[model samples]
Target chain A: MRITERQFVELIRKRAPSAGGGATVAGLRHGLRQGIGDDCAVLAHTRQRDLLVTTDLFLEGIHFRREWQEPASLGHKALARGQSDIAAMGGIPRYAFLSLGLPRRTGQRWINEFLAGFLRLAAASKVVLAGGDTGSSASGFLADVVILGDVPRNQAILRSGARPGDEIWVTGTLGTAALGLAVLQTGGKLRRSHAAFQAFCYPEPRLRMGRYLRQRKLASAMIDLSDGLSIDLARLCEASGVGARIVEASLPRLAQTPLRHALHGGEDLELLFTVPPERSPELPRRLGGVPFTRIGRITLERKLWLIRDSSKIPLPILGFQHF
Target chain B: MRITERQFVELIRKRAPSAGGGATVAGLRHGLRQGIGDDCAVLAHTRQRDLLVTTDLFLEGIHFRREWQEPASLGHKALARGQSDIAAMGGIPRYAFLSLGLPRRTGQRWINEFLAGFLRLAAASKVVLAGGDTGSSASGFLADVVILGDVPRNQAILRSGARPGDEIWVTGTLGTAALGLAVLQTGGKLRRSHAAFQAFCYPEPRLRMGRYLRQRKLASAMIDLSDGLSIDLARLCEASGVGARIVEASLPRLAQTPLRHALHGGEDLELLFTVPPERSPELPRRLGGVPFTRIGRITLERKLWLIRDSSKIPLPILGFQHF
Candidate 1:
């Protein structure tokens, strides 16, 4: 039957009689000061601390082809993908909610295997699977994970925190996931020295490293390496009202790989940050075994540039875009 | 390329750093008590009031057909569907997180319109849209909503609360949504008095009435009427370790429709509850304008019966089931 949005909404209102009880409680509407309408859900856990809550959808055929990946890997990667945003905000993940839209035909064994992979990772990170909803889908599988984390009332490290003098640093390697993607697409065999295949299938979230940077007051700004470094770096620069320049020799490229992959590839799930030169010295060279490298510095030119040998060239901002 | 669940999960662990400092200070570790290995995401909010969290996915072809619905109605219904579960638990909803997977080709207008409908209802109910992640899908639309709510440690209700000899009561009219569905399918006109069309499209959650019942010590057991009366009632009975018997004539069926709709139709979003006979007289015939009907009584027979006209027969348990 043809149903207009209004008619559908009216039907919902008819069903919802138990909403809005918080009007009776004072000071309870912090992050939700704007109420419920917006692109992102805002919440106030404390006066200065706003808890931002959001979920991401990863459908089997739509986001990944199941035939190429194992169930456990799919589950773990899904959670990591969501947590990357939390790391970008310099927040610590406290709770995770997973909603699975399973195809009825999928075997129970597949689900068990998937959970085995997800739970192992969750246990290691001390992330709780707080709650989730389940339903059956007609064809492809879908996983929507909602992660809840908190930042200090005013200390949230936003993409907008960088300044012209801030130095940029990236934790661990970059472009491995992207390179892994290329390898997978070309049906190439995995080389022992090149772990890009693993990087592609399962990307890690640098939660501890992010928290360390935030807690120690080291980073002026931070973002995770999900989209390619160039695009994501551009986003941080744009948010911070600045630009950036990178020394080609300073970048921590994956061993035995093309520099192009490291520059343009994505899904590294590493922490990228900017710090004042003075604070950069205080930052650790490694965080929880992940290597740290000083790649570049933020600049006022409002353009992203790459330096190689002696020539400085413009770095194109290219990465994944859903739209 | 090929990724195993184990390898995928390992990738997540490699990326996530250890939880430190503020994460420890906030006592956030308590949130992940379940450790993530189960079918459901386990969370313990309070020793006395443990929170059960779950999420559901609704896709275009999987949950509903786009040809039969408007974007606004779909949005509203989505929120209402999740809230109904909270109501069933006798809990007050505090926040909601939505993850939407839209087809890249879907118009921006559709997204805005959908959010407008969703937010309107959310605002009225004081349900804050806390946070969400967005991604583009290649095929149909997908929406996943995660809701958080609380119940008093001592007063929290569950489906397992009903007992033999408790009188069964249903709040509001039933079968309207089911009838509306039939109308949509048959292109049949609905009587002005029917109002089932609206009921089917938008089902109201009886949150206030639920709170009142809990606060006033009214119900011994309670559940929301999402599935059909027979099906939901049976569930309540099964959970409570009891059975029920209804005077078929006393069942609150909508005016001018098939009895089957009231008996077997779903998505009513009403409250099916039981109260001791001593408290029955104090219960109102209507709570906040919604009518209440005394439909049946809980019995020890371990069977559900419907009495119609002069004969009584066992009622068949039929309702929507995803599995």
Candidate 2:
């Protein structure tokens, strides 16, 4: 019989368990502090630091076909997805926990290669693979990467901080990762050394740029472009109770690239942030020499718009959704 | 076309990206101190405390067949698996992060039921479901649960602490979950209200008992019996560089239960611990109404054995292995 989540929770609550005298640790320890419901849970942190945690799931076939991707690249992308989330929050990732569900047919050589890719990026970013679980799957592989990061206390960049008249900014090119995927899907690989090829297989998280934006107080709100600029910006507006207007000419698209790909193509892993008008000038044009561009402005209209040929056109929200 | 993990890491390391002056987080922030290789990652905690982190993976078909199992029970079991690891370390669980690789055919109704089952156990145990990742899987469902827990510094028990002459103890009954599974598998018409069924479906992690044992300094080493007594005990002995001798008759077996099931049946989330001769008197006969039994003692022989009546027999290590 199919059961509803509501009914299940209700039944459980009714049968909630209690302990005999002094058996439970109820008042003995400082347990969980925040979240049965929230985008993320919060733990009381050490002095001057706020801990940030996020988890990402990567499944074969849905995420990447194992045949087309190297085991090492799969490993790298797995950790990269979670690291990108840490970068979005302007925090430095400290530890990574990987849970891999591999099919029983997987060979030892493949397993070792996967760990190599995963651990390399971790070492580059100073992230340690702390602990993880492994299990045999009858089907394709599934991987989950949980990353723990820390930001200066109260210095976290949240998508809810965008406000009216805030200048919208983006780091790096928009469709690089998507271009890599397009090339793979179309079976039109340019070259292994090509930028698009590398971008698709091994996208770098904008860690330094996120840190710069946070430390310089250059941005009011921030999110990573994992789900494309269109949907992610819409989410930012929704979270901040505002809207946005993007200048069509300002997008940093690769030559000959479709604007739609730059707008809706996901997996870019770039930072999309909004700067309050007063802090706009303090924002650098080049952060550590990586191009940073002003792409739009936050509006109070509560509608996303694109400024094309001096005309305001409503932009469609199209981005990747795992579900 | 296969790239070794070593080669991939070396290549990535050689091409590592760089940043401009004064942009990096620098020495201002202290990062993760341990856990590149261990069952759990350790983080410096507030004063005399240390953070313990562990993750567990449960896959459809491999760990459980969803066809027969209820959604609520699946959710409860998912969190229980991770909580048991925390108990194994003598820590209190704080937050749980789940990454679910759900099939495309899964319904909202089904998803809700699963979460209901999961959250119910969380609420009872005071663990917050802080955050998680969800994605579509072409294959059957897969879930990875990561739990963050804490214990007073250096107080968390490990598998390596058993000494010769330490008395072995176990909290709760052995093979109860396996019996439940066997009943279900054989389509035996056992009453729904049976304790075996409840134990199998809603296995409780001995969090309180683990804390009690650690605080009272009774257990020299500890491990939860996720696997059967035969394999888990062997592991404990191997870790401590010692052997063990168990009186088979002392195992708390259910009436009519087969001796084989008690030795090899997995999925029991009960704590198996060791206490020195001097400290054995401090352990209680029961905690939270769960029976505590002294099953055996750590021996210097470097081999695990079981005594039945007048005969001493070598016990084969036969617990579940993930890979």
Every model's TM-score: 0.84, 0.90
Q: What TM-score does candidate 1 reach? A: 0.84
Tens digits of per-residue lDDT, candidate 2, A211-238, equal 8888887788888888789988987898
Q: Please give, for residues B1-323, the per-residue lDDT of candidate 1 as tens digits.
A: 23332343343334433222221133234544322211123333433333434465667776677666568878888888777776766677777766677775677567666777777778878876655556666568888877766565445566777878889998887787887877776766755344786687666778888878888888988877776899889878977888888887787776765788778788888989999998999998797898888989999888999987888899998776544
Q: Model 2, residue A281: what's the lDDT?
A: 80
For candidate 2, give the DockQ.
Answer: 0.39
Question: Candidate 1: misplaced stretches above 4 Å?
Answer: A1-28, A32-42, A46-52, A151-154, A191-194, B1-26, B31-54, B151-154, B189-194, B300-303, B307-312
On residues B135-190, what C-alpha lDDT tens digit does candidate 2 reach at each position?
Answer: 77788878889888888766778888999999999988888888888888777756
RMSD of each: 7.0, 6.0
